[model samples]
Target: MKVDKVASSPIPVSQLNQPAYPQTEQPQRPTSVRPQTTIEQAITATAADQLAQLPDIDAEKVTAVKNALARGELELDIHALSSAVMRFHTGHE
Candidate 1:
């Protein structure tokens, strides 16, 4: 509780108001420089470009399949289809 008994601070009182080290100007990076693209990004862009060139749906193939189904030429393998679907959902071979 006595002021005379209190220990003095290790740092000088003058240094308390000022920074410990001098501030230096940092070099700025050039804004014109572009970041390099990763391999994954390049592959994805290539895939997207390839996909854009292809048709969304094969109309000719769809029409042929529809005609075949209507003619009863394409037999519906319900058991095999169900088994394949079950395997897909279960992640099994």
Candidate 2:
């Protein structure tokens, strides 16, 4: 407000509030994407079913071992089973 110790009006800011040229249309915006893919939906459903079954299993594994055990042909790999269990608990794999 002071120039050479004199009081005077400041320049107007009304000219600064608007664009120099007119705008003709609204700006374009990107569209939203799908919430989930088909594969993702399938995986979610499978995981849900697995959880709802109360117990987890590999069905093919059980079937393969079934007849083998019945015929006394099943073999236990203690080291492999122990390693798998350790990996599951430790999330190392």
Candidate 3:
């Protein structure tokens, strides 16, 4: 939960006069960011478009379920469902 003051600062101020921080020596990582290749960027855009096209809710399935409920035809095998759910939660096949 630490913030990089140097990175987040509005402007890069010269710290030439300041004494070095007495922290443990670690290899410095490069801060420069490289641009993604055109193909990579295009693939990302295509993936995002595919995700956006997906329905928030499966409308046909929802309608079918609602109709079944209204007709009192919605049957649930409680024991089988419960066992399957329990097995799933316990990570047992």
Candidate 4:
């Protein structure tokens, strides 16, 4: 049976023995932050109102597409579809 030696660590032994420097001053941080409650509430309410105005689905369009697919009336361009998907994934316009 043969055995191979393990690779040595990349860091030098001298650097491992060095002492870390002490921090002289503490970093200043904000003690208190005031919340903008009214502004946040107004924004949330506006978003909710806009979302409520939107329809979940267009049933007429969905049914038409489904019927066309079932009847073999719809044709798909695979190359174009794949290109569009690639462009979307790569974030190209």
Candidate 5:
């Protein structure tokens, strides 16, 4: 019978002395990009301009809306209605 010494294998000297692999380069980004205005600012500016050019409010339309609200005939989701109204009033749509 023969016995083998398996743990006596030698490591390469090149591997021991070699430096680590270089890292990959990343893409450069723009440096002086400006931030955009908020939705509220845009809405306000548009609404102000539109309102300045509008004629006097229609009394009939005001009365119709008031009557509808008083008689529960106007079923409105106020949040959605307000958002839509703001868009229309602002000429943003």
Candidate 6:
């Protein structure tokens, strides 16, 4: 009886010689230290300036407006209010 020969494969050596994969660069974000002020701060600042100008104004009305602005119950536009203030001052002069 005759026996048939089978072909055998050798292990690949290229994988052992391969260099490590290159690392990809990651995107960097900018670092900021300044803390952001809340909307309430802006509203309060504007309201304070308004209150300062109206020294004889009603305390209750000013307090109500300030509270409303701080709680977001009222919307305060500094630019518009400033313009109104300027107009009021000019009218008085």
Local lDDT at 3 for model 3? 71
lDDT score of model 4?
0.87
Please write out the lDDT profile of model 3 over residues 1-93, one tens digit for every residue. Answer: 997656565544666546687577898877997876798899999999999999999999999999998898987778888889989999774
Error of 4 at 20 (Å): 52
Sorted by TM-score (best first), the order is 1, 3, 4, 2, 6, 5
Model 3 TM-score on a 0 to 1 scale: 0.38
Candidate 4 local lDDT, 1-93, one digit each (tens) = 998886887888888887788557887878887776798899999999999998899889999999998899998778888889989999763
> What lDDT is obtained when candidate 1 is compared to the true structure?
0.92
lDDT of 6 by residue, 1-86 (tens): 99878565374667666767867888786686687999999999999998888868688999998999899999988888888898
Off by over 4 Å in 2: 1-13, 19-64
Whole-model lDDT for model 2 versus the true structure? Answer: 0.81
**Cα lDDT of model 2 by residue, 7-41, tens digit:** 64475577667788978998786696556569989
| lDDT string, candidate 5, 1-93, tens digits | 998877653877677776678677898889988989999999999999999988788889999999998999988788887889989899664
Q: What's each prediction's TM-score?
A: 0.52, 0.36, 0.38, 0.36, 0.30, 0.33
Lowest summed lDDT window (length 10), candidate 1: 1-10
Clashing pairs in 1: none
TM-score computed on alpha carbons, candidate 6: 0.33
Q: Write the per-residue lDDT of candidate 1 for residues 1-93, one digit (tens) a residue.
A: 655855888888898988879899999989899989999999999999999999999999999999998999998889898889989999773
* Best candidate (score: TM-score): 1
Error of 1 at 35 (Å): 2.9
Best by lDDT: 1
Tell me the lDDT of model 2 at 14: 79
